[model samples]
Target: MTGRLFGQGEVGSSDLIREAAKRAGAKLLEYELDAQFRCSGSDGFINWVDNTLDIRRTANVLWKREDVYEFRVMDSVQELEHAIRQKAAEGSARLVAGFCWPWSNPNGDGSLVKDVQVGTWAMPWNAKPDAGHLGAGIPKSNFWASDPGGLEQVGCVYTAQGFEFDYVGIIFGPDLRYDWEKNIWVGDKKHSFDSVVKKSGDRFVDLVKNTYRVLFTRGIKGCYVHFMDEGTRKFFQSRLE
Candidate 1:
């Protein structure tokens, strides 16, 4: 089954597939997999996420299984990093962020530039695809989620997708923010680093929402997050309260 919640850039493949089948005069069958294998097998957690993100309304608005699956919001980027690192010692863990910063290439000395900066806190994005020779412990874009050294760098939606970790730390960037006055989520393309997604025009907001949905559900055991936007953070906190 395909999940539109995880769709990025343009429309998801399921839509295209359905359209093609209709045009070819072929009847298509679809099935819904209601069972939850991710987020500690808590279908409630998934529903909670959908409701929380304003993606759709679901029965599980507030998460009920705190003991079974962990979900936390951190005060700062530093706190998010520390929590993820601590979890990494016990099991697989990775830090991921929204496409809010430029992914810079390594220096001539094979040193990574800290492009993701929030206040005084800064960290480099995962190694570039052509990062021929990374410094001692850094992993290339593909292995960022699985490698031990991945903790040192921040990952974006591209590298973090299709991977599962025991725990995940996410930096909720300014690209997507909740408008308190209007009671809506606003997507600012100016704050987004993903040029391809920004080119999606009006669809950018939904894609950005889906990107976070993917990030939020990456952890099987737990997920921690740091929000750059205070109003947006408070909006999320209100849903739980």
Candidate 2:
């Protein structure tokens, strides 16, 4: 019974997952946060779970290069931005909102991306992420749980794997989308900075989708997504309709 039913990468699919988990009587879980924004769970804690732009385009600092793993810039997405902000700022729930993808390494000098943090450093960058963001495998850092409203830090399947949250907001990057003509999810290696995921060749799309799926299901109360690719967003919209 414990397996993945990862639906298509649609927009509200995470919401559906949350609903289904609730129906199943899944216990809601949250991270333990300290004043410094560091977060963790009580011993033996275990559960499975579940963006915006401008402020996002300006704030999302985690990247691989100028173009390789950059955030998709758009004209307007502040509502999505505000929802995340509201969850972190007002909701009593311990929330974490972030991006998902196959790449996001530290700058060349083993330093977190500066100027990206709206204020100070937090999750996604709090833990000393890998220096190059080029690890062949998924990142092993779990910093998202620690971030407050640090939009710059984005967590993928790698960081979100064994944890659950009260509410989770996700940024679905451009690495994966559907080919309307071909009728299959497509993984654009060009959009991926992780050499391993890019090198997956035939498995690239599956890996990407699964990565986002992990991100989507990392919340017990709710899940939200802001897709970077218009095509992917449209595909999701169609599915939701």
Candidate 3:
């Protein structure tokens, strides 16, 4: 228990952990996750960009109290997927990723995380499209079990934690949205079918924020989001602008 437990400050919802670490005399080091071209996940490859990385800021940078990332907000899912396809066809897709379930909320149009291709498994889970919370679709499995080099299939938090990629396409659904009148993000458990999220209740908002926080930070280079809720999309767009 006394041993230091280190974590990435950029993604983890570990404020308490970091505070405790500071009390324990640990020095926190910051690194920039700014999207840049890289060949491999190996330190040797990452080292090649270290000079550039050291001078940059994180892709998900916090300005004031809002989180910001240099990104392209696609007008539609089709347009978003097209961008994904381009990254893939260019060989850079080796580390490009897609996120969220085909259906983020049941009440809304049941959408799938389009794989942007056919005939090959973009990720390990692509081989099993019919696996998930319900035994019939993409399984809500752990990222550790995933094929490290895989990139085609969409990855949820469970399959993406503690991992970083060159690029990620986030499909933000209606389950989490913004209330302009209230000026606060609200979490609707009923909209989410995920067992863990549905049961969060009072803690739902925190969980939702962390969920997206974890997802958004998965990309070391950049992220593009297709928000299902126009309100939320507009809210984010306003901030980015």
Q: What digit string (tens of lDDT, one per residue) describes model 1 on residues 166-237?
A: 999999999999998898899999999898998998899999999999899999999999999999889878
- State the TM-score for model 1: 0.84
Q: Per-residue lDDT of 133-185 in model 3, one digit per residue for the tens?
A: 32233323333223432444455565556555556666676668889898777
Worst 10 residues of 1 by lDDT: 2-11
Q: Which structure among the candidates has the greatest TM-score?
A: 1
Supply candidate 3's per-residue lDDT for 58.
37
Measured by lDDT, the strongest candidate is 1
State each model's CA lDDT, in order. Answer: 0.86, 0.46, 0.49
- Sorting all predicted structures by TM-score, with the top scorer first, yields 1, 3, 2
The stretch of ten residues in a row with the least summed lDDT in candidate 2 is 43-52
> Which is the winner by lDDT between candidate 2 and candidate 3?
3
TM-score, each model?
0.84, 0.52, 0.53
Error of 3 at 187 (Å): 1.2
Clashes of each: 0, 8, 12
Q: Write the per-residue lDDT of candidate 2 for residues 99-213, one digit (tens) a residue.
A: 2322435655444543212223233433334443422232325433544433444544545565566556665666776677876676777766666677777877666666665
